[model samples]
Target: MCLKRGRTLLQYAISPAVWLGVWQLASMAVGMDLLLPSPMAVAASLWKLAGTPQFWLSALFTLGRVCQGVLGGVALGSALALLTHFTVWGERIFAPAIRVMRATPVVSFILLVYLWVDRATIPAVVAGLMVLPILWGNLTVGLESVDRQLLELARAYRFGRWKTLRLIYLPSLRTHFASGLLNAFGLAWKSGVAAEVICPPALAIGSRIQQAKVALETPELFAWTLVIVALSLGLEGILRRVVHPREERGQ
Candidate 1:
C-alpha cells in the first residue's frame, strides 16, 4: 500500500514538473512577458493581489451575485419543472418555449437583456437563463421517474398530496435534483461572470478581470482567472461535502 501511495505521489509530481519545464521553455522561446507570462510571474501577481482588501471585496461581491443567480435559477427552474410535471397543459405550454431558451445563444440573450436591466441584474438573468433549461429538463425527468407502484401505494393508504410528496416524491427525486443543481450551479457562475465582464459591473471580479485585460497586465489577468477557478472548485467541493457526504465518506 505504501509503495502504491509513493508511486501515485511521484506520478502526480512528474506531470507538474513536465508542464513547468514546457512552460519555461515556451516563455524562453517567446521572450516576451506580454504574450504569455511565466507561471512564476502569475504566481507573484496572485500573491500581491492576495494581500489587498479589494481582492477579497471583489471575490465576495462576485460570490454574492453568483449565489443570487443560483438561487433564482433553482427556484424558477424547480417551479417550472413541477408545473410541467403535474399538468399536461403546462407541459405543452412550456415545452416549446423551454426548447427555444435552450437553443438560443447566450450572447443574444445577454444583449437583449441589457436593454432594460442594469449591469448588476444582467449577471443574474444570464445565470438564470443558462440554468433554467438544465434544471427544468433534469427535474422533469426526476419527477417522471417516481415509481408508480409507490405512488399507487400512497394513494391506497389515503396519503394526502403533501404527505405523498414529502415521503415518496421528494426522496426519490433528491438524487436527480441534487445532480441538476450541481451541474447548473457551475455553469451559472461562469456565464454570470462572463456577462458581468461584458456589462462591466462595478466591484465585480469580472470587471477586475476586464480591467486587467485592458491594461495588458497578463499576470494580473492570470491571477484573476486563477481566483475564479479556485472559487469554483472550492464551491463545488463544499457542495459535494454537504450534499453527498455519505457517498464521499463511504469512498
Candidate 2:
C-alpha cells in the first residue's frame, strides 16, 4: 500500500514537472514575454499580486458569487425536479424549458442577462443558469432510477413520507446528489468567471484578467490565469473531499 501510494504521488509530481519543462522550453523558443511569458516571470507577477489587498478581494468576491449561484441553482433545480417528476402538468410546462436552458450557450445567457440585471449580478445569474439544468437532469434521473422495491417495502412497513425520505430516498440519491453537486459547481465556477470576463464586476478575478489583457500585461495575465486554475483545482479538491469523505480517507 505504501509503495502504491508513493508511486501515485510520484506520478502526480512528475506530470507537473514535465509540463513545466515543456512550458519553459516553449517560452524560450518564443523569445517574447508578450507572446509567451516564462513560468518564472508569471510566478513573479503572481507573487507581486499576492501582496495586494485587491487580489484577495477579487478572489473573495468571485468565490462568493460562484457559491451563491451554485446554492441557488441546487435549490431551484431540486424543487423543479420534484415538481416535474411527480406531476404531468409540471413536466409538460417545465421540461422543455429546462432542455432549452441546457442547450443554450453560456455567452448568450450572459449577454441577454446583461441587459436586464446589474453588472455585478450577471456572473451569479449566469452561473445559476448554467447549474440549474445540470442539477435538474441529474436529480430527475436519480428519481427515476430509485429502487421501486425499496419504496414498496417502505409502503409495506407503513413508513411515513418523512421517514421514507430520510431512511430510503436520501441514501439512494446520495451518489447522484454528490455527483450532481460536483458537476454543477465546476460549471457554475467556470460560467461565473466567464460572465465576469464579459460583464466585468468591479472586484473580481475575471475583471482583473480583463484589465491585464487590455493593458497588454502578458505576465500578469498568465499569473491571473494561474490563480484561476489553482482556485478551480483547490476548490474541486475540497468539494471531492466533502462529497466523498470516506473514499478520500480510504485512498
Instruction: Pick the lDDT winner.
Output: 2
Instruction: Residues 1-251, candidate 2: write the lDDT tens digits.
Output: 99999999998999899999999999999999999999999999999999999999999999999989988999999899988988999999999999999999999999999999999999999989988999899889988998999999999999998898889877877898889999988889999999999999999999999999999999999998888889999999999999999999997
Q: 4-63, model 1: which lDDT tens digit per residue?
A: 999999998999899988988898888888888898998999999999999999999888
| Candidates' C-alpha lDDT | 0.89, 0.94
Poorest 10 consecutive residues by lDDT, candidate 1: 195-204
Of the candidates shown, which would achieve the greatest TM-score relative to the real structure?
2
Model 2 clash pairs are none
Model 2 TM-score? 0.96
